[model samples]
Target: METKNNKVFLETIHRKLGFCSTTYVDPVGLSGGLALWWKIEVDIDIETSSKNIVHTIISDKSNSSVWAASFIYGSPNREGRDQVWDDLMGIGRTEILPWLCIGNFNEILSSEDKMGGNNPNPARFTSFHGMLSVCGLFDLGFKGPKFTWRNNRRDGDLIMERIDMAFANAKWRELHNQAMVFVDAAIGSDHNPLILNTSFPMQKVGKPFRFESFWTTKESCKSIIEEAWAVEYEGTKMVKVCKKLRGCKEKLKKKLELGFNPDYLVTEKIIKGKLEDLWQKDAMFWHQRSRIKWLQMGDKNSRFFHLSTIQRRQRNQIVKLKDDSDLWKTEANDIAVVYFVGNLVTWRTLAIIGIIPCMVQVVGVFFIPELVKIGKEKDLEATLQRLRGKDADVSQEAAEIRDYFEIVQQLPKARFLDMFQRKYAHSLTVALMVKSSFYKFVTFEVPKTLSFLNCHEHNLNQNKDLTAILVFSGIQLYVATAVGCRVRVTDSHANTLLPLDIKGSAGSLITFCNWASAWVVSYGYIFILDWNPAGTFFILAGICASTVVFVAKLVPETKGRTLEEIQASLTLFT
Candidate 1:
């Protein structure tokens, strides 16, 4: 439109785009021009025009609201910019309705809005900033590039500035709060086009599920699949296989949760202490999220992981670039996991590498059998390599594992009758009591007290009595933590249910015990709410004593005996 000598040539271009009406500010002999076009039935009336501005009044046609839009084309000359500023201010004074003033203003509001440009005159910024402040207009932040105008220059003397801008009054901004301006690609001109958007579609958070093929490494997978598929079912062969797959999924999930027992982790050795135990759970979660289902996983998982990330980056329009300086670095790409098999410890490391003396701060390190030394010189030369030397403790344990398992394999089979005997029964009873009470204290009182403080703040006594509430909460926390710490199972006490075992029986037992405790506490809360606190305590005390007596009469002992002997004795005695 800049070089089109007259409206005749411009009309041809305008007609091609299907514009019905156009309000034109003809170019000053190809030096400058402005064009504002509207689709048919737009309900916009052109109120005013100038060499650098096009003002219009717009109604929604729905009898909803009316607004004013002033399209600005600011002058590029250093001195002529002041004229543009005066024109905007004059128009701003007359805007009574919600106003949106936008277009290529040929100015920027801040220094950061320019790249590779001569330092902006501070007075120019003050002029624009002062205008906005005085008129109560806000710069509507854009969605695309920070700088709307690019130099597009390969020469050493290249520059870019955010000359184009959009500002709205408070009412206009509030009406379209998520409004955005996007920069379109340059077509036949140096300046890229600007697209204003009033509504954006919402994005979904999480993705769909897809199984991973990496879970086959765990031995539990084989047994779980076998057990699931072995069952007889009346169905089509495909349907039968799918039913078996569903069953296998459930079994594997339960197996994966084996080591996530919160109390067991805090009390007994955690999975992190045994990677063989932790590996299955990690595989389960990663497999569920990775969404790759190939038979032979190999390096395909990693490859697909990076490829999807790259595609996503493109979709999101994320720019990964540098401005000819290694001092400024981006350390977001690449991943390398170095594992030390001999010991149970984790170290997270992120080291950036690039040409021409780049630098990134590496965080955390682990001994890879031996030490992993990372050295960097003044010129940013560095080496990160794994070296090897086995620890004596690790070697000793590795040697003893076979002997330890062999002894365990020799032990006699365990049964339920073994749990019910004349001795050691009180220990199991106490375990249940302490576990129940700990959950009750933390789950019931802590939340209840906090709720009371928040929901009934005005009803409470203030100032002179505030210290009493604080002290009470503090004491409650201290006692709970103290008792909770003590409630962790002693190794001797854990052996009580050894015959019942961890895999086949413990999950159901623990779930039952927890649910039973919850029900008991729920029942107590009812009486405590309507009756005396004394009545509730008395009922709880009776339950505890009744439990002790029940254990004494029905349960058994396994103290100071090997598991095989204990199982044998209990089996014969019962």
Candidate 2:
């Protein structure tokens, strides 16, 4: 079953795994090795091989369709990884088939790609991004733990990253739109194995049989039930009742042949027509209830109609009402329904609370000066000087804002899609990275629900300490914002495309990411924490810590810099 020889070892594994063929590229100095085992039904043609990668053409025996795949084990050395990128670029140019590249590339596309460690070299990220762009490939997002590889360290020096991944081109995505990748648990190895399912798994569903109310209308139904009830059964009272009901259901089903109906169309039409009539009658009745009879009589302006309204009002008016238990009562009790029951506050009180705050804003708007961007030239200069301190010179900054608005007025209005243009790709990438990281960090820190708070309270063994968690989170967020402001301060339009629409779109993205992070973390807390709380918390803490490194390594500093200077710095990355 086992052998020291490489071929014999691989053959034994292939045989046990029910694979008909096996091949391997031997390891060099315990670093580089490659192996593949496949079933006899699959047809794979080896196109090229190297120490770093093996390229092959895979043919689906069932469909007679072919696709190319590159199995990579990239070199750890910098120069060697760069060579692998070059080789991929070359293959991307010549190969016309839909291609997929999957394995450990020994490189990361961004700081977000790794957890626990110093930020990776920016050059490596640039190279990886360039390679993917040249090849028109994108990550096929996975469903499992965020990271696929982790160091087997139990101490503070532990690290984990998604070094192993899968990428496919648009053609491959189109051909296999339903395909998905799953990360299996890593049993003895550091990296988890991936399972690529080309189609969704089949689910076996058992439908329970129920007795229908309509089945009673059949003439034979009563006889079927009577016969079932008359049969003798051996069980307790509850079990006997269940058996009788089940027997009656089965007899009725067999007698009626419920699976098929010859008169389905005729019966359906009659029922639908009756239902439509009922709906119309119900709608009309409600519509009549909403009408005001007094207003309708007044609108007619007729003596007879007006007299009838007055007579009805006089008859309905109460002179004295009898209380419950037939006692006479003079004082009227307020029995109106409370429409706004939130916190037991009525609608009138809620309206007053809302309107009272708006009075201050309505009055304060007149005293506030006009904005520099849209106000008259004189007002713009005065507002700018007041904001910048009267002693300071504000002519240039004022002119810049005014001139920018002037140019904006002359240009055609931008659409939402303008934010996604090629020229704005760098800005979009930065925006998404910052927003997602910010939300993920915040979502993890805050308790998503009461259960989450209870979990923390249970762990801390003090209900009062819950306040400390929230207080520290608030202080941390404030300090982080202050630090971020110190590092980057620029005009809004300098780093954004379609600035008017960015707020709405960014808000939507933030909300979606927040919800997604909450959902993921909830599952992680439920499933992962039950098994290993330390491991779960460690992964979350690593993610939170990595966000700080991501911002430091990726975001450009704009402190005390002009708009032109900021753009010049960002030019290097784009």
Candidate 3:
């Protein structure tokens, strides 16, 4: 036996295997099982076994089940069928046990099994009954006279055959008193199907009640009775007419459980209408509660206080409905309770009483120290000005230093210098020149000489005592001057006086090895020489050599310059 869906297929397989003797087990919304039916043959050995029993088991990809005896069997050949009968006889002989072989044997047992009476083939029936006798098996009584198999054709007189059968051992015959097959109506099939119903006297068992079934059922049977009923009461003072009728609730619940069976229960129309009414009522109640909660939780002003009270009353009503247990309770009750307790009224009251402010204070502890630090730093400008005193200019230099310190505090120390240079290029430039005047002088003069060697003269000066240095690189001549000392290089062609001045007492003019092209100076000395086309270094070397020669050739000592004589000499030089 098989079915279209695998679940049904497995179920039918189980039933045919004798695991299920009655209606097959199934969940809701599933139809009956068997699709195609066939019979098979099997053998058992009662002689060699402890108990020679034929096991019928149905197995699909998902699940399997076994039965004590099956009605479905298979054989490889005619010899296999004979061999199976021999094995059953062997079991009966050895173990003194009875055997049963049953199933859908694909071949017809007899030509008489076919419907519309073609002719009965006596030989086949004789052979099959002989095999059963040899195995000590007897046929269980069936209610049908015609065979179970027919050619699946509608127009012609259909060919039928008795393919499915059940045979049991002598022991089963004694144990089971009544077993008969019932041929059901032709349900879109030429084969009039057969079912063997055996009375096993098994008790029925009920499964656990699922809450979903009850809930869905209650929703369907809500309106069988009238909406209002007048009840008369005998009271001491006055007769009161009670109108809230909860009558017929139990009846409605039972009807819901029966489901929408049109034949036995309420009409589908009434069930559907009641279900709709229940659904709408439940949805509207929840929706109203939700809106109320939203308003109470979201509102900041007291304008909705009265509305909030009305919402609270409505919420209480909903809660009462939910708590009744009969009205179909849900898990949303806990959530509704939380919303009611945490309403806007309560939250606002807490805020007004400074409870929220206290919480804010607790939260503020972590950030307050850092904020204070920032405030102090922001006020540092005024503090720095006061620290610098009234006459202080609050120099751009000092401000920049403070800015640098601030940056260094914020950034890494390695990046502090780079950031300072980028922000204050001019200040950094002046500072660099002051720190390395000698390096700057050399750099400036060498580039100037290469660019304007014949066009201009160059002059440079350095003061060791004042730490001042200056250079003048120009056309015609190059001159470098220092504290209380000066060197002058005159244009050789002009033969003009190259002014050389030494200040203070013990100062004197010294000239040595003057050349036609260039000149150099050292101490209170001067040297003029020809330009070396080879390189500037050679020219500088020659100048230094000439300066050495001047110091040796002409030496005059002076302590410092006299102001009057220095001014007079400057006037004479001009």
Candidate 4:
């Protein structure tokens, strides 16, 4: 209200808020002032003005409905309030239309409105109450903060008051019966901004379901989940999974609703312990001083006077955010209690950061060699039992793990040098499969598969869909041909050149390399294909070289030889 009527400031405001027609009361000696602005869409005329008033006549241009709105700023001091009350009485006499009296009255009607202050004077409260009664103005109900004006203090001596309020006469109330005054989130201001909304009754949104970690400690949690999952549902496996999850969600929500209470966060229990510690320290200090105890300015329990001091300092300052949720949520009072409880026991945090890793992960790493060696028919069950917690039943599981581990111990452990042996060509094929799988998934398949699935799911088909389909079919045919050739490699020659396992492994190796080549050709030139033309020749040359080498070296002329003779001939080269 004390803002200077500067040219730059006015122009900036106009640029921001647009060129709305406005009338304002300027402050006297930088003390106090007011401004009323409206769009051309709504007709507003200044009816009158005074030191603390911006009375206006507002009309709906479409409906031609009119109302008298009195924007009041009650005198800051109690002495001048009497004159403001008198002015309000005079204004009431002139009110011919439905009237709305809004803004800060700098007064409250009850002791409940003030916090951390001495009981308000009964006479002052009565005077304000009486004025509202005579003026036919009743307080319009509000949502959000019960207290609007905070004293800008977060320390123990912080004060809050509900002095600012909206009051409408009976005719005005009937005109917009659902009208509400919401105390919007405060911006660390002494007073919260008030919003008069007549559109609809604001709803206090219920909080969504949140699974708390503490629920697992309750015995009922297991029973609730089991019961919910036991309910039958008809669907595919995915649909059943979703339905069961929804059932569990509802059950957990119901259980929490019945058990949860806000009182658990009270500071009384912990603050009392803090006071006890403080008492011990204070007694020690006084005893050691040995004299002048009475001369001390403070009492024995001075530090413990108000547990309210435990709350966070300056933590109440919250700024407005674009999201609507922030508009109704004010800073909570229990923030300090949470901090006090957290700092009171720092070991919980330390245990999570330090000791937890050793118990679960670090110990497992140390035992890995022994774990791998202990493979048996039942050893997998033993590992699972260890994971489930010591209290779980594990006698049967232990036996299962032991049997499973023993069975696993009988299997061959393939080694690197084994792959080089002619009898174990399968290992080399396995290596190629692993190498190509990575490249194919990352480069060739992922982007195309994702684009295809997305297009179908979202009905996002473009004209290029047929090209994508043709490319898919071509890839399938190429893969089939490569696979069939691997099957016929043994048939092409009368030689038992490789064991069946080795032959299959070689085939897998060939198929993997084929995909790997496609991945490189598809993705490698994608970037340079835009800038240079030679990438095409480089790819074509690679294909030609691969075909020539295959025909010239890998293909053998073993047309009519017996299996044993062909094997002997290939063996000579080996």
Best by TM-score: 4
The TM-score values for the models, in the order shown, are 0.36, 0.36, 0.24, 0.42
Q: Candidate 2 vs candidate 4: which has greater TM-score?
A: 4
Candidate 1 structure quality by residue, lDDT tens digits, 461-481: 233256457646644654565
TM-score (C-alpha) between model 1 and the true structure: 0.36
Ranking of models by lDDT: 2, 4, 1, 3
State the lDDT of candidate 4 residue by residue for 281-341, as single tens digits: 4544443333334534335543222211211111222312222111122223343434454
lDDT of candidate 3 over 51-110, digit per residue (tens)? 112333322222221123433333425654555555545544543333345555544555
What TM-score should be assigned to candidate 3?
0.24
Tens-digit lDDT track of model 2 for 387-415: 56879998887677666556655666555
> Which candidate would rank higher by TM-score, 1 or 2?
1
- Cα lDDT, model 3, residue 424: 32
TM-score: the better of candidates 3 and 4: 4
Q: lDDT for model 1, on a 0 to 1 scale?
A: 0.54
Stretches of model 1 off by over 4 angstroms after superposition: 1-5, 204-574
Error of 4 at 255 (Å): 36
Local distance difference test values of all predictions, in order: 0.54, 0.60, 0.39, 0.57
* lDDT minimum window of 10 residues, candidate 1: 355-364
